[model samples]
Target: MFRTHSFVLLALMALLVLTQCTSAPDRSTKDPAEAVDVADQELSLTEEKSAGDWLQEADAAANEVEQHSALIRAANAFQNEHQWQQAAAILSQLAPKKITHHSQKYYRLAKARWAAEQKVWAKVIEELEDVATQFNQREFRVLSLQLLSQAAYQQQDYWQSLVWQVDAQRFAEQRNTDTVWSIARRIKQSELPQQRPNDLALAGWWRLVDYHHQAMTHPDSLTSFLNQWQQSFPNHDAATLVDIWLEPPLKPSESELEAEQAPPEPTLAVLLPLSGRYKQQGQAVRDGVIARTGEMKNLRVVFIDSEASDIESQQKQISELSPVGIIGPLLKDKVAAWSAQPITGIPQVYLNQIDDEAAQNSLTNVFFALSPESEAQQAAQKINQQFPSSKSALVITADGSSGRRMVDAFTSSWENEQAEQPTISYFSEREDMKTTVERSLGLTDSQQRIRAVKIAAGKIIVDEQERSRRDISAIYLPGNLQQTRLLKPFIDVSVSPFAEPIPVYASSATHELRNRLGDSDLNGIIFSDVPWLIESSGKNILLSQWLELRNGWGLSLARLTAMGYDSVSLIQRLEMMNRMPGLVWSGLSGELHIDNSVVQRKLIWATFSKGEITLAKEADNAGSRYR
Candidate 1:
């Protein structure tokens, strides 16, 4: 009987152990993703050290032989990092140095100095006057004279800048067959004098060479100019100009190098495929460039239909007229065609940057009006500033090259802004993708911040059988209307799985999101974009002109008109600050901010609710938005 009792007790103990084992596995042992809910609910977004502040650090990184290069690089670094003071400090160091470099170097230094806003005219004039001396490098001297005149004009000494410009022309003409002749030609709106220029040889010595590079369309302009200049005056080195050319634009101030105006009757070739299927965008860009030409002097834009069957044919035709500059050929393919044809010794500012194949052996006097790649990079920087805490930025894109380009640009910007090496998760699709996301946030455990919060919000419920993990803070989803809409349900629904909510961000949250997903679908969702339209405020003397445009031109046309006015009027402000290069470029377009071609006209944070986007608040932040 005792033996039987012992056996029964041991069996009872074994049964009890089995019962406990069979119970729903405790969160501690169920799966790595099981406890993810608890983590996601509690994790808060962490702030990254401002990438904009890297300028100061980079400036401190400058060395001796590479002093100028170091300064330029540091400035570029600061601009890329958005470090305003660091850029200024590096630029200011050169301010006190006597102007000894060639006009090219001076031009470059002047631009950097101007960008840094340290006495632009003072520095420009200081170097220019030295070149003005007959003893200076002949071409550089002439260039300096013209640049000096510009500084003088900037100070409302129009007569002075003009006089100096004439002097520069005379000097460049003397050095005819040199690059300064082009400067004088471009300066004169391409209205070359019947009297061969006498001052072309005395173009920008050093500093001047570096300054106008920002406006150069053809990458070879500087290269070609330097090659000839060095050949002519090899004993007098002008190698420093390269440093100025590579210097980054000001981070705080927007110093887009634009000539005052192009001359009228100046055969401006409209190099766009106006007759092709892609003619609409080409036309749009052409219109913007053309309408503004009137604002410039002697600037008659000749529309050269680049709608030929082949780019080679179009190039042959375009060369005959030898327009002052060519704009458009909206498609890169068209540009590729034009690239095959050699330039007609005329300046060309392409609306887009040339590809490596074309740009490699392309003609002189060519440049990209605005490189989309550059703009994309700028837009990316803006994203980081606007949304610093964003973790996984989802890019819902259409399957195309343009979409890929946008993604690439966003990625570049994100990488530049990401100081912590934080990763921005990307998604490419057009359907329900909850499973993929759940895996990222943590399908099984809930301890990871992104996973835990995602799970807690019920956005991605880790079933008893899933696995997920994510090292992120937020989500970025950028795509077309359809792609964005498809992502809406997944984002909103995934969050629903948790008790609280996780922020889902996008580049553009427009009418498309609400129309498809419904208002409540993207309730707390956030997005940022440069709206096509917005209200404006400022002392606009041209407001009357704008009003007139409103009457004659559509809002789009008015905006275009505004662009011209702003471009012209901005010189006034730039002239006044002559030395205040470090200040931010704030103007009429709300903030008048631009990373590159992608200007941040306005960014309004909104939540979709009931087919309407409600602007949450006005922002005075310095950085761009999150992805």
Candidate 2:
């Protein structure tokens, strides 16, 4: 097993440089073939001789003659012994022209592989490009292209990566029996398409992939884009290929969709603090609920002022009204007070989330809120889902209870998904945010930077040397709009601009307010929120109309309005959801699914680019830098 693994390593580390070391003076005067034959015999007797013994014999044979075959044998033995540098050294010693074509190809590939291991990306690309352009064998060419694709991707030059994959696909298709098509398909499907100049094939292909990616989140736009692409690129092969995705989504049959189930309770009651300090919030909730239920024939909703000073008095008045199901009491204290009691015979949905340990555990009724924790969890989930390569996260959060909970929720959710535990840092003041971020990201390693600089005897030199840790693949900041805006630039400047950009993820708190100038600074930060807030598709007919009528609304209040809108529909389906655990209801808030009376909302995502907030699609460009 060790030998097999070693052989694979040797195959990959095949070397390429033009330089060669002169033969040793005491080298044997035997024919090159004779030396190789002896080495081959020693390799064959691996069971008799230890790997160390075989390596010594191969080394002697390689040094004795300036033979390509002998040198390759020595390199193979070195690789098998896990002496990667030694194996690379042997391959480097042999001139490409002196070696057989097969050995030469492996030699060059090995050089590229070794360079990649050293993070010498330029050398890796140079060698791989040589093999890709000069190699005659299709398999070798494909291998070179594959490595080049990876190399380009690592450099974040996704355009070059896609181009290489396209070339690989063409070569693979020529062979017909090769499975490289799957490789191309995986890359195309997973990567976001970038517009390529002077390459019609890629440009056309980009449209198809872009359409497919957008369609995942916006199915309504798919058919229109499909038609546009087909019309624009009439005879392009890429256009023909899009036919596979052209299949429209399957709609539920009229009977299945309209099938009669249990009718919702005749009377739905809304519990709101209509005449107290929380009047504005309660009114918004009431307005949203009323808009949705206004046209329903068999349904009547009673709006009850739930701000009665005595908790018992409020409950008594609610019970007297005799609502089949109650929605809200949009205050945390009220929800906590009610959660202490047993179920109130009537089904209830509270619009405020309670974080109190006992209150959370005691709830029998459905608890729904625009929870910061839930939003944090969803943000972590979406980041993990979108960028699987990003395992480690560096979190920068504020030093308050709410901020701490948001970070904890994010970390817990990420870790629960079996992702690595994130590194966390905190700041108490806005003034300390930059310093906190720099320290957490290891960007403030000034001592190390000073040591890295080469000082002159008398004069100062190399003043601007900096280094930052690269292990962090993503950054999670659960701050409000201002904090998010300030921290993003600090993060960007703290790390070396040459390093690969780590993706920044935040909860809805970051993007909650619609401030163009404020959001402009938050460009490239990916965050998740309720679909109703980000998407302008009018999926929620009544809610969209409400927003249109009210030109501008507070972000906090708007969320409550959505909570109210979903509450009405969710109440109607709560009984059915309990019966069918697998059933999910798509509401304005998100894709709503319930587990243990706690409604989990899988929110939609969006990112800020060029001062505009756009719905994030499942494409590579979703996280790409603004051009």
lDDT of 2 by residue, 1-627 (tens): 347676555434343211222334554555443344333223220234433443344344444343454555555555545566756756656655455444555566767766766766667678877567666656556767877777776655565666776777566635321232222232333344454446665566566556544544443475788899998778765543456547555775889667736544578878899987989889888877886687466787888788766767767766766576889878888888777773455777878777665554322377887788888887776667665674577888889998889887887778323456778898989899888988887877864666656453236656565767787778888888788878988999888777898888887776554552236777888887777777863264655667676667666777777778888877765643432223466777787755556677888877887877787777453442212
- How accurate locally, in lDDT, is each candidate? 0.43, 0.65
Worst 10 residues of 2 by lDDT: 176-185
Candidate whose lDDT is highest: 2
Candidate 2 stretches greater than 4 Å from native: 1-265, 309-313, 342-344, 355-364, 416-420, 455-463, 516-518, 537-552, 619-627
Question: Taking the tens digit of each residue's C-alpha lDDT, what string does model 1 give over 417-443?
Answer: 333443333454543355545444554
Worst 10 residues of 1 by lDDT: 38-47
